[model samples]
Target: MTLRRLISALLAVPACTMLAAMPVQAAELDPVRVQLDWLPTGDKAFFYAGVAEGIYRDAGLDVTLAPGRGSPDAVTQVAAGNADIGAAGINALMEAYAEGGAPVKAVMSIYSKPPEAVFTYEGSGVTDLASTLGKRMAYSMTSAPWPGVLRQAGLDPDEVNMVNVSPASLAPMLAQGQVEMNLNWVTKQPDAEALMEAAGRKLKVLPLSEHGLEGYAYSLMASQRMIDSRPEVLARFITATREAIEFSIAHPDQAAAGLAKVVPESDPAILEGQLRASFPLIDNEISQTEGLGVFEPQRLATAWRWVAESDGYAIDAIDPAALIDSRFLDTAAQ
Candidate 1:
């Protein structure tokens, strides 16, 4: 057939038939592995929410969320390249970077204030920080900040008889009265309170933040390699995460459902309560004044000071500025 006749014949074919002949090409998505500081919990529902809502995928990223045993594990994994980014306590990152030069830096702020608190059951007579001077308490590695906090409360760390135990044993010991109290994060308060209530007692929370504990707590950290080699991907991931955080705040129930879908063993109602409990930690005075996900210099310096003093490391060993890279956050804002 002549060229004009051939073109006319092709043009007469149905649009659906023409479309069916075309090959489908899926958009490529960048890979991002994220390690959480602890088990999948309500405070961490936002990441799961983001995944469930396809926010990361919409940003051209395939994100994986891995549960962590602790902030130390999360920091170690990120530093070792097993995770591109992680959620960890800033103090843990500071100590890891200062003590061993871990190649990780916080990219965004999560908890603006330390969530450490002392939990005790009713009738334990531990009404305030001063009341626990000579009482026995469960102590674990996460209790590092309590020493400095105790000193600030005008009580000697030595005055309290500390029973060394694993993190998992803290609640059991407190509920059974094996220890008068135990140190835990405020984000887990609801669960702790429920445990105490099950034991026919009320839980008394002595938040260390009110006892002169000052510093950034949980934060989003990234491996130096990722921050250096994949700045754009990191920015996109951060932007998507920030959006997920806002979504979690606005719809706690939806965030819980998202997390429950991924972590089927989780109770959505409990997760929702946990996410609600975290709002104060996320939207506190510092975050309010500086804007969300921002790291103010003075606060960073103060955080370093508290961590350094608590760990007996020289405050000058690692500059607080060296522990964070805000360029990605700036990029995300753009």
Candidate 2:
């Protein structure tokens, strides 16, 4: 059967029935906290949809979602056992493994591809990465992947005068010529574009993935101890999340509404644009083939190697497999 049909049929089934039909013994509903990598936005549709649609409750979980300051803060919360799971970039997880010896494993990938990119005004004379040399580039102090992109382009990041700018201020800074370029995520690209169009201007976005800086974007992660002790809970969470993601893909407008409810201050037009921008980044293939929270060992190994070699960590000291667990997702699929 086609995926659409399967998803439709799954949606038709009663949530209680689906929960009761699962073979593995269901765990009692317990409070599970998830720390988001940033504040509410359309990029977080599936998560908000899951909550708004009662997916987590149907899966027998009392889940609480918390906003994180950034990836590092989210990872720290998970590592400290204060949060059951944390949503963050896989790069942050690698850094945590290298520096803090945090036994956190990425359970589910949200964006299949890296969302980082450099944005410049249209006709800025900077058409590509090579042209960005010696230019002023604005970047967030906490964002990952920019360093890798600069290194791969053979540009010393230090050579470019860098300024700290908020994500929302990127387009404004570009429009005013305050910075030659700024790094942003694809998820934020739509909002940036909308903001530019509002002022009757245009911009160019150069995705880092297209420039050879590849890494998984957002992911659901948990500590090794939690995985060992509460595997069932993780599996249930993944199942519920997979249901939510599939729902979002099939019902984009509904997903947008769900996001709007959580982020009421967001402009509908901007939210719609953000949703469209993020569509290509969400990987249906990974969700279908690997189940919900499964991590590809080889892909993760590549990420770890990139981090270790560039960030001054001993490669031999880190094992990628130790930082991921697929059993929970696998169980959920069954």
Candidate 3:
């Protein structure tokens, strides 16, 4: 063989060998499922914004955002490995811990304050917790806030004529006098009011935070196995969510428009009102400073104790650490 041909053959042989040794390209993005606590609302703006803005895609995730029936459903879905992450109330996390589920941890707080409250019509003669006693009250049986509010108000939840209403039913029930009082979140009041106004009525909202019904409202939770195996994915998810939250705060009108696209059934005016109402509740600064999604351990402990004591569970049955993993949030914020 010629010297030039021999050299070329040698290079070609190595090139072929190198090609054989290389690993095959995998899927361009990792799949992740995020289960929301309920139907789309302004409270979930960050999540919707993340998906709408391709924030998850930018973070190397192919995220699927699913609506959960409620907090319990979201917890069960994550615990059963059906979902990679669940956004739900922290109170639900505590309840799950008390019940001994596949350990779950909250990675981020969506609402800086608890989102729940007691809402009444302007002329319902129910201005406070004391007034709600003996009045027909509407709430979802599965809502974590209901039990807390009931216990706090010293009302026999059963004696108050509890009505199981969907979150969307709050306005209609209130307007028709089907229920004299409604338990809901501050963020939801605007939507409820808009619905009532559409029916030529007005409503008043009383935040639970003002009535000693305080606890972490919503958080992003993941299973222990997922946290142990793919923490980087969780961190990336949190980072993207945080960015979406920041964007939502800075541009409420655009955020409302983006959220409206996701929940097409939602009234644009209602969503706009909710977006404005939720502005003060999304405290990205606190989350950034304390580490994304990190609730005060002491507060968590207090909440655990409250749940155990109020629900007649043994104190030893609860372990706050098992219910939450703040380290993922700390690493994500960094």
Candidate 3, residue 140: how far the Cα is off, in Å: 1.7
Ranking by TM-score: 1, 2, 3
Could you tell me the C-alpha RMSD of candidate 2 in Å? 11.9
Give the per-residue lDDT of model 3 (tens digit) for 1-334.
6999999999999999999976453388777888888888776766777777778788888888888888888988998888989998777777777777566788776766666778788788888777777888887664445665667667655566678876667668887888888877788877677667876767888887677754466788988777989888888888888888788787777777888997888876777677667665557455556644677777677667666765677877867766777777777767
Better of 2 and 3 by TM-score: 2
For candidate 1, write residues 256-297 as lDDT tens digits. 999998788887888998899888889878888887788989
Candidate 2 lDDT score at position 261: 81
Top candidate (TM-score) = 1
Candidate 2 Cα misplacement greater than 4 A, ranges: 1-28, 142-144, 154-159, 284-293
Total clashes, candidate 2? 0
Weakest ten-residue segment in model 2 by summed lDDT: 22-31
Show how many residue pairs clash in every candidate, following the order shown: 0, 0, 2
| Cα RMSD, each candidate | 10.5, 11.9, 10.9
lDDT values, one for every candidate: 0.87, 0.77, 0.75
1-334 per-residue lDDT for model 2 (tens digits) = 6999999878878776878865443466666788988887777777888888989889888878888888889999999988989999877888887776786788877776668888887767678877887778877775345666678778776666778887667778877777878888877887777667776668789888788865466788987777988888888998898898888878867887988887788876666677667766776565456544556776677677667755767887678777777777778778
Model 3: residue 194 alpha-carbon error in angstroms = 1.7
TM-score of each: 0.90, 0.84, 0.83
